[model samples]
Target: MTPLGRRLLILFTAVLLLAGLGTGVVLHAAARADRADQPQSGGPAVSTGKLTLGQKGRLAFVNGAAGPHRTAVASVPSTDPRGGRTASDLKCARFYAATGTGVCLQSVTGVLKQSNRALLLDRNLRTLRTFPLAGTPSRARVSPSGRFVAWTVFVSGESYSSAFFSTRTSILDTRTMRLTPSLESFSVVLDGKPYHASDINFWGVTFAKDDDTFYATLNTANRTYLIRGSLSRHTVTTLIQNVECPSLSPDGTRVAFKKRVLSGATLWHEYVLDLTTLHETALAERHSVDDQAAWLDDHTVAYALPANGKVGSSDLWSVPADGKGAPRLLIAGASSPAPS
Candidate 1:
């Protein structure tokens, strides 16, 4: 063969190879996009619609189902949690609503770092205000009267399962627009004495009917404590040890919290603490739950557990607050239960 013919053949072969590689890349990208748009098999049906915190007898949460509505603030009838879900346009990583107010934590990718923020929403699900967050959002709650909102974020490590991590918790009064940037500034009373430490961290705040009273998990010296706090006094007092993510009951007489089952392990079991007697009752849920539980009513508490055979998703379950009944599935492919 002549030299000119050989050179032309080589050039043609290279062009064909590059074209094939480019086509493959495009196909792979398209396939990923399609998967994200499609719903997971056996996932609950969700439709886009208007959702409101003031809707009577409704339960709201962050939709974890894989579909177009994934991560959107979704709601189901409190009486029919297994029924179809109505998703709103607002998306959040964590959310909670009470009375007529909602708090939504969201993250946005930026050029240099991920930007996190919290949106205060009205009864109509409209954004009333936005507050910048210092890190990745983990937990959120609103007071029963809908006057106060609180959120927790991990400033260092992302997971509670990690051996070392730092958190920043903030509370805001919607009526006056007063903000408490971090709970660490509150005076601490540990074991009936004033305490101070650089390692103190607070998270998973749950408020009582009285706006001034709240409960949260306080961690320091490799131990966790349930602390009762007062907004007016700017003070916190340790109540019990080994308690995390306390959720006050609707009646404000009890708190549902996750108790660490194994030392130095991430396993935890749900328990109900009677505020009057300081008695703790182990709940019927045997599975290790790692969520801040929410009260469905005065007698029931709902929380999230990892969905079976699904990654990055969870299912909401409820059991009797008295520790007598078994856990019942409240909602599939959902997290952050906020019942009203």
Candidate 2:
């Protein structure tokens, strides 16, 4: 399909869900019914990725995940104000907030041969400048300290004629722009191989509270797992497995990610795993709802999900930390959810 055709197809599907003209309500009712076997509660009926009581939230997402991708930096107020205003938009890629205010971010631009670029945008979304990366890097995430930046790159050998994939993971000091040398035949990771994997990989990195340690989402073999590592040691251990997303809790004892179950392509559910025990507990299940999870507090986890996956059919929602209440909608059809 053409790029515009694909985009319109995506948007049209989004519209159907938002209008409740799809199976969104039925799916949600079934999910809530499933929770009867779990727990029950009477809290907020709906909590948005958008704030409703002066408690603003931050979510950096590519508004259009399809072709002609446009990076959108959005902040939702405590109140349902204007359906969460867009703070800024970048050249044509995904973005992550470097500062709490969404200042520094890394992005990709089809305009530059899909070259990886670092960006600094003012509060109004004006382009301050763009820094090209050493090699074409992938997505980016800001460190917990808000001072350093970390991203993954596949130091692979793929060309027009040679179409094989073996990507090595790399990190950069966003403040310094210094990249750790590639792992040479197990240079950093001694026990396992470097981050060389087949295609259809979805690896993302995150830092610990100290900004010295890292965590990533790796899909290998037939199962997916979350791995934790340190930049200083360059060694990784399987923190937990059979899960994706790999977002760290503020306290660092729990991880919120989308755990695949049943038929993975049919269902993706939100889960929070205890780091020490590796025990996973489910939150909610809605098709096409995995990708991002944000911790609101030690007991609350917020996420973005599609109320419906039809035309214009996705919405943001959150489930309780204890799995006691039904999943509640926060907003409609958002791709990313970041809690402050």
Candidate 3:
């Protein structure tokens, strides 16, 4: 063959090989994402092996759909004492808000394919659409504007621990139920043990009003901190740390989070930190309760207290942001609460 013909043949072969490999990679990624996104259900199916036969998962008490009447509702199974790792047959309950015609969610258990799920309900506790998650959802949060939803999940690897690896975070359109994959494969140096996703992991997910940027929590060898990232930039930067369960304020200036207190011999307290000063102040102390907290507004925050009066069995409670007002028990003794 002529010299030109030989070179042409080699170039054609290389191009064909690269094109084939690229096509394969694209197809494989799409297939895996599709499989992960398929609607599969499982959660604390039957409170048998781990929990008491009918243990409540989580509860949320909100204003009724009508006027003046208050409603107390619980998630289908309500409480997941076993944490996120033991989700199987779900018992998500459905209820509608008694006020403002706003949508809502209760407790349902059993999640096999997805990690985090938000149950939508009507005022009377009626089940509506079940939100299925893709990849491994970590920090699931309703947008600060309440117009969107976002979650951080394990995207590529199965390493759900404190290790420097890649992870994917998803933002969903509540109005359309459409998921937009934003930041994927962001890595942080986690100098710690092989920590599970639920263990010492990032559960602090909050969105800004503009919905362009959001925050997430991640635990490292030393301390747990918050990270701010934008979909446009596809990057994350540390905002604050030495804390967990961060709930950002509505106005977007302050972030309310529970400071890390030693969970040993005797430790159960709530701490709020100032984002600007990086100062942490104690908010409340429950001798036996250690649960997640959320913010209702600038002055109001919701928290959970164990129901057993000792350990386990958590109920929802609301208190002032500055920790001055008397804490009010809202959902009696139940577990889990997600805004609709």
Candidate 4:
């Protein structure tokens, strides 16, 4: 053959091989997505239905099961959390509700970057308002009186375990339609004296029933502190150290939080802090819990742990608030426990 013909033949062969590899990768990805839509063997049964935030004695969560209903807001009877689930059409990455009001954090893929938003939902799971988010959603909560909402997002790094990340926490008054775009704008009082820093970040806001008081995690100087915030005063004061993701109890007497088990480590153990006495009680769950817990009632606290043998899924587990009992499985294939 001529030298030019030989060179052409080699180039054509290389192009065909590259095309075949690209097709194979596309097919593999499509197959995985197809599998995700099908129901897994022995998974919990879920049905389409109207789910309301005002439904008394029901537990709502983001469904993590593999099926068409995956990522939908689902509910099971609080008395029988293991029973079949009724899933709503609304889907969210994180959700929380109180007194007929709900906050849903959602992410939508765009052509260039992912868009994130928060939806203020009514009792029937209808969108009452929508607020654009600055980054990826991380946490969400509604005040017990249903008059306030708050959420947090990671503005820089994706994971809290990363050494370098920034967060933006926002608060909204549902009745007045007033919004506090960032908690960093509020005045800070660290260890009695006024404090400020460029590296400060706040997240995981849990509100009190009073509608003006809230608690959140404040991070600065490589240390985490629990800060009690007031909406009326536009200020936050440091309460204690090393507390993250504070979830206040039903009666507002204690806060369920995850404390770092060691310095400079991502591991955490859940503990309850007495607001009056300033004492802490470690819960019975021995495994590292990385979620902001939800109070099941005055006596119990619930949180999600990664599901066994399942990727990108979690299960809800509950333990006594007094720190004496073993962790009990509350629901399978679920996360973001919201007890109504």
The alpha-carbon RMSD values of the candidates against the true structure, listed in the order shown, are 1.7, 14.5, 18.7, 4.1
Q: Lowest-scoring 10 consecutive residues by lDDT in candidate 3?
A: 45-54
TM-score of every candidate: 0.95, 0.62, 0.53, 0.91
lDDT of 4 by residue, 136-253 (tens): 9999999999999999999999878997999999999999999999999999999999998999999999999888999999999999999999999999999999999999999999
Q: Where does candidate 2 stray beyond 4 Å?
A: 1-71, 79-86, 89-92, 98-139, 152-170, 180-202, 263-266, 286-288, 307-314
Lowest summed-lDDT stretch of 10 residues in model 1? Answer: 36-45
Clashing pairs in 4: none
Question: Which of the two, 1 or 3, has more TM-score?
Answer: 1
TM-score for candidate 2: 0.62
Best-fitting candidate, measured by lDDT? Answer: 4
- Candidate 3 to truth, TM: 0.53
Which residue runs does candidate 1 get wrong by more than 4 Å? 1-3, 6-10
Give per-residue CA lDDT, model 3, range 33-105, as digits (tens). 7765332244222211221112234323332211111223323333432232222222422222212122333
Off by over 4 Å in 4: 1-35
